[model samples]
Every structure is written in C-alpha cells, then in structure tokens.
Target: MRKLRVAMIIPDNRDERRQYDRPEPEFGPAPAALLQGLQELPEIELHVLATTRRPMAAPAQLGERVHYHLLPAGRFAGLSGLYLPAVRALRQRIQALQPDVVHGQGTERYCALGAVFSRRPNLVTVHGNMRAIARLHRALPFTYLWVGARLESLAVRRAGGVVCLTRHTLREVQGLARRTWLLPNAVDPEFFRVKREPSQKPWLVCPANIVALKNHLRLIEALAPVAEKYGLTLVFAGGGDARDPYYQQFKARVAQHPWCRHEGFWHRRQLLEGLARATLVVLPSLEDNCPMALLEAMAAGVPVAAARVGGIPDVIEAEVTGVLFDPRDPADIRRHLQEMLERPDWREQMAAAARQRAAQYHTPQAVAAGHVAIYRELLQIPS
Candidate 1:
C-alpha cells in the first residue's frame, strides 16, 4: 500500500536554533508530540512546513519518513490578518510538494491562512479560540487578537474540515467550519515515563504563561490563605511579558508573598522535573481549550486542580481524575486546593486515575492513530 502523504503547517519558535546556535528546528510541545507519534507509524509520510522570521538551517529529513521544510515569512505577516505574502509563498511550495492533505496547526497565525489558500484537501486544528479570546479581552481595533479573530473565522470557514480539541471548541466552530472533528491534543510519551518525586515542602505547580487570561493574580489571591496555612509553596513556571500591566501586578503579588515563586520560562525537561516534584498541578486560567499544561500534568502522574471553565471540565472529571473549581470564585479555588492538600490519599488516587486516563486517551500513538483515521476518512480511503 502507498503511504499517505501529509503536509503539516506549524509554527517553529527557532528557540533551539538561536539559543544553542544549532540548525535543528523546534515546535511547541503538542505538535512535537504529534509528530513523534506519527513518525512511528509506517503507513504515513509526514512533511513538516514551518515559517520563521529569520533564515534558519534545518535538516531536510527529521526521521525515516518525515521531511522538514523551513520557509521564510514576513515578521508581521498576519498582524493585520492579511497574510498575503505568507499565503502566496506557502501555496507555491505546497503546490510543488502536492501532498494528499495539508494540515494547519493553528488559526491564530499564518499557518491556517497558508493551508486554506494552498488549495489542497486541508484541515485546520483550532488550538485556541481567537474570537472568544478577543471578545474576552475586548481587544481594540488593529490589535493582534482583533486581527487574529477575523482570520480565524475566515480560515475555519474556508478549510475543508476543522479539528476541535474539545467539545467546547466544537461548539464554537461547528457553525463556521464545513465539518468538525473532536480530537484531543497529544502528550509527549516522556511525560508518562517520568517518575514522580513529590517535594517535601507541599508544592503546587502552575505551568502556564503569566497572562491576564491565565488569571495568575486571582489565583495567587485565592490560594494565599491555603499556602500560609499548609506551609505550601506555589510555583509559577512559565514566561510573561514585563511590559504587560497584568504581569506587573502578578510580579508585585508574587513578591508580597514569600511562599509564591515565579520561576519564569522553563524548557520541557525542567518542566517535567518540576512536575516530578509537584504535589499537585494547578491551572487557574479564566478560559482554555484543552490546555497542554493540564494534559502534561496528567501524563506525569500528578493530580490536577483547574478552573472549571471552557474545555477543562472535559479534560478533568470532578473528584475522579482531578478537581475542578470556579475560576471566578476565589473561595471555590481555595476550597478545592485546601481539600487536595489535606487529603493525601485522595490526591494519590486522583493522580493514579489521571495517569491512566492520559495513557489511554492522550498518548502520542493513540492521538496519531486518530489523526490518521481522520485523514483516511477525508480522503475516502477504505479502513
């Protein structure tokens, strides 16, 4: 049988290239995990197409059957939501490659524009709901979120199909897209392999970027009493822009409380290490759609306490695999955190259940198989 050729348009941070001065390209964790799972399958040939502002050398081949292509895109290609140059370049390259399907990773940037305009049998994954986010922030005209929201709608409407990470996303995009599929994001298998090493000091780790929507300030305020009472250390393990007002406030709050530690950005290894030492993983985001942080925590055998908003309820079953709380209510957040900290046996049971859930549903191989099934169905190939 002939291998199914898939062209995946994704974003590459160019972090490894610039940091280590190496030529290898790096993708966000979710895409990287999907690629890892897909590569192990013999029935597919994968071509990764990533855009960068500056030129970077990348190997032509990633593994036995996967090809890599790094293309140059304007630094502000989709800032205004046009993405004309990027779309043209991507379409030309994709036409030349002539893959069976073009898969765009996200709609917030140029990837969705590139894939939809490629004029191929294409599908796009809605990693974030830009329209909802823009509305939440009341994003003003000409801002990134405002522009991205418009482009997101356009891309979803034009694409042959849409991959919704959760039912929340499905409800958001079903009206816009031609068709939609509910498929969760994949977790790196390495997360599952890491052995848990709980910290002696009660540690609650929140591994999301310090942004307004992440609701870090509220989280800090809500968990303050719990932290003080239990002598618990709360760690924030993601990056934030210093110029942002919310970030400034978050830093001030973190400083006021000695128990709070903002560790800032961490690589995958460091994050996994932190997770290993974490007594519990907490996500206090105001809105999210199957966040990779929660998925990673589940895979790492840590019980999660997250805001009961968006698709979070889908990822965590209250009191079963993990705990859920009202993000808007500080009291609810405190109650759940306190309960999880107080009941060690319950936490352990939830952690075990969460790990089993992650293994069964969100594993790389399982997600890869799901993607292949979607592709075959789109192509009308017999199972």
Candidate 2:
C-alpha cells in the first residue's frame, strides 16, 4: 500500500535555535508531542513546514519518514494579518510536495493562512480561541490578538475542516468552520516517564507564558496568603519579556513575596524535573484551550489545580483527577489551594487518577492515531 503523505504547517521556536545553537528545529510541546506520535505510524509520511526570518542549517529529514521544510518569511507580516506573501510562499512549496493533506497546527498566525491558501485538502487546528482572547484582553486595533482573531475567522471559514482542542473551542468555531472535530492535545512521552520526587517543602508550579491573558499577577495575589499559611512556595516557569508591563509587574510582585520565585522559561527537561518535584501544578489563565502544561502535569503524576474556565473543565474533573477554581476571584483560588494543600491523601488520589486519565487519552500514540483517522476521513481512505 502507498503511504499517506501529510504536510504539517507549524511554528518553530527560533529562540530555541539561537539559545541552543543547534541545527535542529524546535516546536512547542503540543506539536512536538503530536509529531512524536505521528512518527510511530508507519502508514504516514510526514513533511513539516515552518517559516523562519533568518536561515538556519536544518536537516531535510528528521527521521525515517519525517521531512522538514523551512521557508523564509517577514517577521511582521503575519503579526499585522498581512500574511499574503508568507501564504503565497507556503502555497508554492506545498503544491510542489502535493501531500494527501495539509494540517495547519494553529490559527494564531501564518500556519493557518498557509494551510488554507495551500488549495489542498487542508484543515487547521485551533489551539487558542483568538476571538475570545482579544475580547478578554480588550485588544487594540491592528494588535497581534486583534489581527489574529480576524485572521482566524477567515482561515476557519476557508479550510476544509477545523480541529478543536476541546468542546469549548468547538463552540467558539462551529459557526465559522465548515466542519469541526474535538481533538485534545498530546503530552510528550517523556512526561509520562518522569520520576516523581516531591520536594520536602510544598510548592506549586505554573508553566505558562507570562502575559495578561495568563493572569500571572492575579495568580500571585490569589496564592500569596494561602502559600504563607501553608509554608508553601510558588514557582513560576515560563517565558516573558523584561520590558512588558505585565511581565515587569509579575517580577516586581515575585520579589516582594519571598515564597514566590519566577524561574522564567524553562526548557522541556527542566520543566519535567520541576513537575516531578512540585506538590501541584497550577494554571490561572483567563482563558485557555486545553493547555499543554496541565496535560503534562497529569502525565507526570502531578496533581493539577487550575481555573475552571474554557476547556479546563473538559480536562479536569472537579475533585477527581484535579481541582478547579475561578480565575476571576482571588477568594476562590485561595480556597481551592488551601483545601488541596491540607489534604495529602486526596491530592495523591487525584494524581493517581490523573495519571491514569493521561495514559488513556492524551498520550502521543493515542492522539496520533486520532489525527490519522481524521486525515483518512478527509481523504476518503478506508480506515
């Protein structure tokens, strides 16, 4: 039988290339995990497409069947929603490959535009709901979020299908997309293998980029009193700009509270190690669509306490696999944190259940198989 060729358009982290000074391209956790899963399937040939501003010496092939293609694009074009140049370049390259399907990884920027414009049997995955986020943040005209929301609407309408990370995202995009599928993100296999050795001092780790949407400052305010009462430490692990007002505020607040520490942008291995030692993982984002951090924590057998907003409820069962709190209310965040901290046995039970759930649904192999099924359906291939 002939192999199914799939072209995946995704964002590659350029900072990782410069930081590590390596020739290999790095992707965000969810895409990387999906790639890991896809590699396990012998029936598919994968071609990964990414845009970079500067040239990096990346190999043409990543594995036996997975190939990589890098295209040069203007840094600001996609940010402003004027991504025709990037889309045209991507379409030209994708046409040459002539894959069975083109899967755009996210609608935040160029990937969705490129995939839809590829004029092939293409689908886009909505990782975050840009429209909801723009409203929540009151995004200014022509700002990244504002532009992204409009672009997302266009891509969803034009694409063959839209893959939603959760039902919340499905609801957000159903009207715009011709067809939509609720598919959860995958956790890295390494996370499932992390050796848990919880620190003697209880600490909560939050792995998310520092931004207003992520609600880092609000999280700090909510957890400060509870952390003090329990002698618990709160660790922040994710990237943030030094000049951004929100980032600066987070740093200033962390300084004032001796119990809180901002580690700032940890690599995969570092994050896994931190997860293993953490008593619990927390997320206080104003809105999210199946965040990779919570999924990773579940895979690592770490109990999660997150805001009960957006798709978080879909991933976490209240008082079962994890605890949920209101992101808007400091009292609610404090109450949940206090309850979880006081009950060691309950926390352990939640961790065990979460690990079981992660194994059943969020593994790379499981998610990969689900994606392949979708591709087959789109291509009218017999399952």
Candidate 3:
C-alpha cells in the first residue's frame, strides 16, 4: 500500500525573515501539537503551508516527512483581509504537490482562503468564530476583522469539508457545509507529563495573551478583593505588543493592584514550569473556541476557574472538571475563585478529572487518530 500525502495549512507568528537564517522555525502550540500527532502516523506524509508578514526565503523542509512553505504577505496583507497573498502562493504550491487531501487549520486567516484557492479536496478546521469576533471588534480599530468574517463565510461555503473544534462552532458553521466533523483541539502530552508541585502561597495564573477579548482587566478587578483577603499573587502569562492600546490599558490596571503581575510571555518550557507551580488556572474570556491554555492546565493536573462560554463548557464539566463562572460579572469571577480555593478536596477531584479528560480526548495520539479517520473517509478508502 502506498502512503497517503496530506497538505495542511496552519497559522503561526514565526519571524520568517530569520526562520531560514536560524536553525529552527518557531511554531505555536496548536501547529506544534498537530504536527507531532500527524507525523507519528506511519502511513502518511505531511506538507505544511504557513504565511508570513513579509516575503522571506523560499520553502524549507523541516523533517524527513514534513515539508513547510512560507507565503509572504503583499502590500495589502493587513487591509484586504488576512491571507490574500497566501491564496496565490499556496495555490501554486498545492498544484505542484498535488496531495491527496488539503487541510486548512483555521477559518479566520489565509489558511482557509488558500486551501479554497487550491481548488482541491480541501477540509477546513474552524479554529475561532470570525463572525462573533467581527461583531465584537466592529467598533474597535481593526476593520479587517469584519473583512475576515466575510472571507470566513466564503471559505466555509467553498470548502469540501469543515472540521469544527467544538460543538459550539459546529452549530455556528452548520448548514454552510455538507460534511462537518466535530473535533476538539489537542494538547501536547508534555503538558500532561509535567510534574506539578503546588505553590506554598496561593498562586493564580492566566495563560492567555493580553487582549481585549480575553477580558484581562475585569479578571484583575475581580481578583483585587480576593487577593487582598487571601494575599494571592495573580500572574498573567503570554504577551502582546506594548503598543496595543488594550494592552497599555491592561498594564496600567495591573499596576494598580499590588498582588497582580504581568509576566509577559513565556515559551513552552517556562509556561509548563509556571503551570506546575500554579495553585489554579483562570480564564475570563469574552469569546473563545476551545482555548489551548485550558487544556494545557487540565493536562498539568491543575484546577481551573474559568468563564462558562464558547467551547469551554464542552471540555469542563461544571463542578466536575473545573469551576465555571459568568464572564460578564466580576462578582461571579470572584465567587468561582473563592469556591475553588475554599474546597481543597473538590479542587483535587477536579484536577484528577481534568487530567483524565485530557488523557482520553485531548492527547495528540487520540486526536491524530480522529483526523486520520476523517481523512480516510473523505478519500473514500475502505476502513
């Protein structure tokens, strides 16, 4: 039997200019996890296509079986919905490779647009809800979000199949495509293998980037009273440009609270180390679609207190795997945090349950198997 070749498009923030110049190309967690999973499959060969802000060196092969190509953004990259240049660049690559199946990693970016442009048997994995994001960002400075939303709709309508990361997104993208599969995002097993040693003092960690949609400011305010009462140190991991207006405001607010600290960004190892010492993981996002941080926390055996929104409820069984709070109310955030702190036995139980959940569903091996099944079905191969 011949091995199947698959082309996957993933989103990344690697410095393309320096990628070939350096020994390695920096990849974020999502692509890293998926690549790890897909590479482990013995009968499959994989090609990855990603986009960069500007033109750089040409295509580069990462491993024996995995190939990566970088597409440079043209002058209209930011203004004309992200990934416009990717469509032309990726289509050329797809034509040359002519793989059995082409998969787009996310709907909100050039990956989907490029896959559609490839004009192959393309499958798109909807990462974030662009329509919802556009609605939230309509009044914000970024008007491209609205354009991205429109492009997202176009991509879905044109895709041969759609892979939805959560049931929430499945419902949102229903009727747009005939074949839609629900698959949760996978977490790296390294997070599960991390040895957690609880902090002596109460240490709370939020591992998301400092963005307006993350609702970091409100989370800080909610923690103020709790921090004063319990002397808790709240650490906000992940970083954003200091020039971003929302981040500037977030930094100003973090300054007001003596207990709050913005830890900027931590690479994977540092992030895992922080997660190991954390007493609890917190997420108060206004919008999300199965955050990787939540899964990583669960894999690390830490209790989570997060807002009950988006795909969060799918992974977290309220009071079972983690505590869910209302994102809108600071009181609710405080209430959930207090509950997680007050009940030591409950926290331990939730941690165990969360770890078990990560092992069963979110592991790379399991997720890869799911993708293989989907790809096989799409190709009409006998099971």
Candidate 4:
C-alpha cells in the first residue's frame, strides 16, 4: 500500500529566526503532542506549515518523517486577520506536497484559511471560538476577533471536515461544517512524568496567559481574602512580552497583592515544575475549551479548581475529577479554592481521579489514534 501524505498547518509562535539573541524552544503543547503522536505511525508522512512575520530558509525536516515550512507574512499581518501573502504561499506549498489530507491546527488563525484556499481534502481543528472569545474580551480590541470569526466561518464552511477540540466549540460550529468530530487536546508526556513533592507552604498556580478572558484580575481579588486567612502563595504564569499593555495592567494589579507572584512567562518545562509543587491548579477563564493548563494539571496529579465554562465541564467531573465553579462569580472561585485547601482527603481523592482520567483520555497515543481514525475515514481508506 502507498504511504499517506499529510500536511498539518500549525501556528508559528516560535519564530527563533527573527530573534537577535539565541532563541528558546517553544514547542507549544498542542502541536508538539499531536506531531509526536502522528509521527509514531509508520504509514504516514507528515509536513508542518506555519506563517511567520519574516522569511527564512525553511521546509526544514525536523525528524525522520515530519517536515516544517515557515511561510512569510505580508505587511498587514496583525491588522489584516488573514495574511494573503502567506495564504498564497501556503497554497503553493500544499500543491507541491500534494498531500492526501491537509490538516489545519486551529480556526483562530490563518492556517485554516490557508487549508481552505488549497482546495484540497482539508480538515480543520477548532481550537477556539472566536465569536465567543470576542464577546468575553470586549474590554480589549475586538477587531481581530471580528475578522477571525468571518474567516473561521468561511474555512469551516469550505473544509471537508472539522475537528472540534471540545463540545463547546462543536455547538458553535454545528451547522457550519459538513462533517465534525469531537477530539480533546493532548498534553505533553512531560506533564505526566514530572516528579512532584508537596510544598511545605500551601501553594496555588494559575498557568494561563494574562488575557482579559482568563479573568486574572478577578482571580487575584477572589484569592486575596483566602490568601490572607490561609497564608497561601499564588503564582501567575504565562503571557506575552511584559511590555504588552494588557499585561502591564495585569502586572500592576498582581503587584498590589503581597501573596500573588506574577512569574511572567514560563515555558513547558518551567510550567511542569510549577505544577509539581502546586497544591492545586486554578483557572478562572470567562470562557475556555479544554485549556492545556487544566489538562497538564490533571495529568500531573494535581486537582483543578476551574470555572465551569466552555469544554472545561467535559474534562472536570465537578467534585469527581476536580472542583468546578462559576467563572463569573469571584465568590464561587474563592469557595472552591477554600474547599480544596481545607479538605485534604477530598483533594487527594479528586487528584487521584484526575490522574486516572488523564491517563485514559489525554494521553498522546490515544489522541493520535483518534485523529488517525478521522483521517482514514475522510480518505475512505481501510483501517
């Protein structure tokens, strides 16, 4: 049988070539986990395509079978939701690769649009709901979201199939796509392999980007009273450059609380280390879709106290796997945090259950097999 060629279009936030200094590895959890899983199948050939601000000598082979292509972006990269130049370039590259299937990582960016323009057997994975996200982050600039929604809708309508990372996303794109599949995101194995020892001091960590939807400000205010009563230490990790306007505001607010520590940004390794020492993981997002932070925390054997929104409820079985609270209610956030801290036995039971759930559902092998099955179904190939 002939081997199947696959082109997986993912984001390129790790543009090391653009950096003047030596670049750090930023193999984002989603792409890294998916690529690792896909590469294990000997019958498939995988190629990754991403958009970058500047051009570089790419189409570089990362592994035995996985190759990377970094397409150059147009001047109006951010202003224009979809970079037309990159889309044009990506279409050409996809033609050259002549893959049996073109898999787009997310609809939030230009990748999905590129796949749609290729007019190939394209499949898109909805990593986020732009229309919903736009509503949540109304305080910030919403031009991007408006543009993203339009492009995402077009891509979903055109793509041969759609992979919804969470049912939250599925519900929104129900009538948009011709075919759809529910597949949750995967966490890196490092999250499961980490060695954790309980911190002598009660510690909590929120490992989400400092965005408006993440509701970091509310989390800080809600935890302030709890921190005072329990002598708790909370660490906020993940965000863009510290100079970012939104981050600056977030940083100023975090600095007001003595107990809150804004660790700025930490890569996967650093985040794993923080998770190991954490007493519990907290996510107070106004909206979310199976966030990698929550999954990583569960895989690390740490119980999560997350907002009951998006695809979160799908993973967190309320009191079973982890505790769930209303993201809109700061009081609810405080209450759940207090419950997790006050009841050690209950926390332990939840943590054990979370670990079991992660092992069963979030492992790369399981996630990869699900994608492979979807691919085979799309191509009408025998399993």
lDDT, candidate 3, equals 0.84
Worst 10 residues of 4 by lDDT: 16-25
Task: Estimate, for each residue in 343-363, the C-alpha lDDT of model 1 and write its tens digit.
Answer: 999999998999999999999
In candidate 3, which residue ranges exceed 4 Å CA deviation? 15-23, 53-59, 71-82, 139-142
Name the regions of candidate 4 deviating beyond 4 angstroms. Answer: 16-25, 56-59, 77-81, 138-142, 240-246
Q: Report the C-alpha lDDT of model 3 over 1-383, residue by residue, as the tens digit.
A: 55789999876555422344544566667767878888888888999877666555544776768888776756555435465666777888899999989998887667788787797888898888898788766735546677778888999999889998889888888888768998888898899998999898899999888989999999987878778788799999978878999999999998888899998888888898998899999999988888999999999999998889888899799999999999989999998899888888999899999999999999888998899889888888765
Scored against the true structure, residue 34 in model 1 reaches a CA lDDT of 95
lDDT of 4 by residue, 23-120 (tens): 33245688788888888888889998887665544537767798887777655553354567778888989999899999988877777888888868
| Local accuracy of candidate 2 as per-residue lDDT tens digits, 1-383 | 55899999987777324443556788888999999999989999999998766666678887879999988765543554377767877898999999999999998778898999998999999998899899888999888789889999999999999999999999998778988888899998899999999988788898898988888888888877667678988999988988999888888898999998888889877998898899999999899989999999999999999999999999999999999999999989988888888898999899999999999999999999999999988888888
Model 1 residue pairs with clashes = none
Whole-structure CA lDDT of model 2: 0.88
Better of 1 and 4 by TM-score: 1
C-alpha TM-score for every candidate = 0.97, 0.96, 0.94, 0.94
Best by lDDT: 1
lDDT of each: 0.89, 0.88, 0.84, 0.82
Residue 356 Cα positional deviation in candidate 2, in Å, after optimal superposition: 0.5
Candidate 2 Cα misplacement greater than 4 A, ranges: 15-21, 74-77
Alpha-carbon deviation at 330 in model 2, angstroms = 0.8
